[model samples]
Target: MPAGPPGKHNAQAGGLGSVPALGRPERRAESLAVAGLQPFSSVDFPGRLAAVVFLQGCPWRCGYCHNPGLQSRGPGAGPRWPELRDWLARRVGRLDGVVFSGGEPSLDPALPDVLDELRAMGYALGLHTAGLAPRRLAVLLPRLDWVGLDIKAAPTDAALHDRITGRRGSVRAVRESLALLRSGSVDFECRSTVHPAWFTDADVLRLVSELSSVPRHVLQLARLPDASGTARAPIAWPSAALLAEARVIRPDLQLRAA
Candidate 1:
């Protein structure tokens, strides 16, 4: 089911509530504050037909973010998962997988159980994340079938990374998550959203060079900010020439238009 906005549900838990202890009272599934759902998607899960579940909350504030409404853990206008579940129940035969997307799916404590529920329902699990929560992701790794990881910038460039995420230590967390993915059995791809204002053509080349060992990498054009404002001058997007140069280093790189 698709979403409108969050209602009265409390979706964010303050702590990384430890994966529930065995003897504790059976917790009914925590309410997942789903920001939105794309009932069918082929692009999200690679080869499988999948549904996309956009969970709420992201610690980062990348300027080109299209889903700014999902940045806060506060009440949103998104759909509640219980209702989503009933709809999903009827879609079992039509969909082959489910992708947990963000506002950084790793930020929500309820995710592991959510994964378990979907797995039991015979759906393959996929996740899309910015890799801000390495510990959380490490715990969920074994249950996931595929992952789409967003690498914001080169791991060594902390300054640029922080500027993009508007948070400290985010790059370190991303690097650690990358390490975990490389060591695990899960199939995955790394992608980046590029803006000319934040990165030059040389920078893209350098970033791709660092990611040369990754099995797959994609370069996406960042969405330009709203054009209604008069105070800000519009920034030009990275050109096709830039993507061409990047493909030279990572020959298999994919380019996505804004």
Candidate 2:
């Protein structure tokens, strides 16, 4: 029951269902390449207890990437599905659900297969994504128990967003995903990390207000220079003054240290 790097627990070594393969199982998804795994987490999925599965590969090259190491598709390619399923099999009784997070979980063409395998085992499925592809999101929506959607920038700020993401039109995909989630039956929320240098007080407030129609809209105060993920150089963020302004306009916000 100890929580540490994966070696501590093998939830699926010999259990109810056999471990699944981490390859191209889902015909609709991109592929199944795993980067890392966390056996247990209380914070990742709100109230539910669950395990965190980190998927590898991402198309976006965000400068502040926390997991820059996992961005490459070719590096971690191998038979990953079995490892994931075996690990989860070991955890069947203890954990309530699974959280698929990543360099963008939807990028994997084989994700639907992985999800189906998890569902077959009676484990609830959750996902954390940047909302890169609305079409793919539509595919995963029905199977999702909950989703933590990260909105990086506003739709209007294309140039700034493109600069931060090193990709054009990504903002549109993110926005479309947001709208899709809002209308869906799934329990979901939109969370934006307020990295001060990225946007001004006015920008953040406007963005928050725009998402007000969503049942759950959270404004996260971003922390900088944290090398744990793919974060690179430090950037200047807004002070308490801007944060306070956001608190007033945004109804529900999750503030983190910046």
> Candidate 1 has what TM-score?
0.84
Candidate 2: tens digits of C-alpha lDDT, residues 1-258: 111222222332223234554343343323477666666788778778998777777888876565666677752432256656766766788999998877788877778888988998889898988898889999998888899887777667777678778998779898889888878888887767666567777788777767767767666554445547644333444556765776677646665431
Candidate 1 positional error at 182, Å: 0.7
Which candidate gets the maximum TM-score versus the true structure? Answer: 1
Please give the range of 10 consecutive residues that has the lowest summed lDDT in model 1. 1-10
- Runs of candidate 1 with Cα error greater than 4 angstroms are 1-28, 226-237
CA lDDT of every candidate: 0.75, 0.70
lDDT computed for candidate 1: 0.75
Estimate the TM-score for candidate 2: 0.80
Candidate 2, RMSD to the unseen true structure: 5.3
lDDT of 1 by residue, 1-258 (tens): 112232222243112133332232114444665776676778878899998888888879987676667888853345555556655666788999999886878877778887887787798999999888899999899889999999888878888889988888779999999999998899999988777778877778888999899879887776564566422322554556776787778889887752
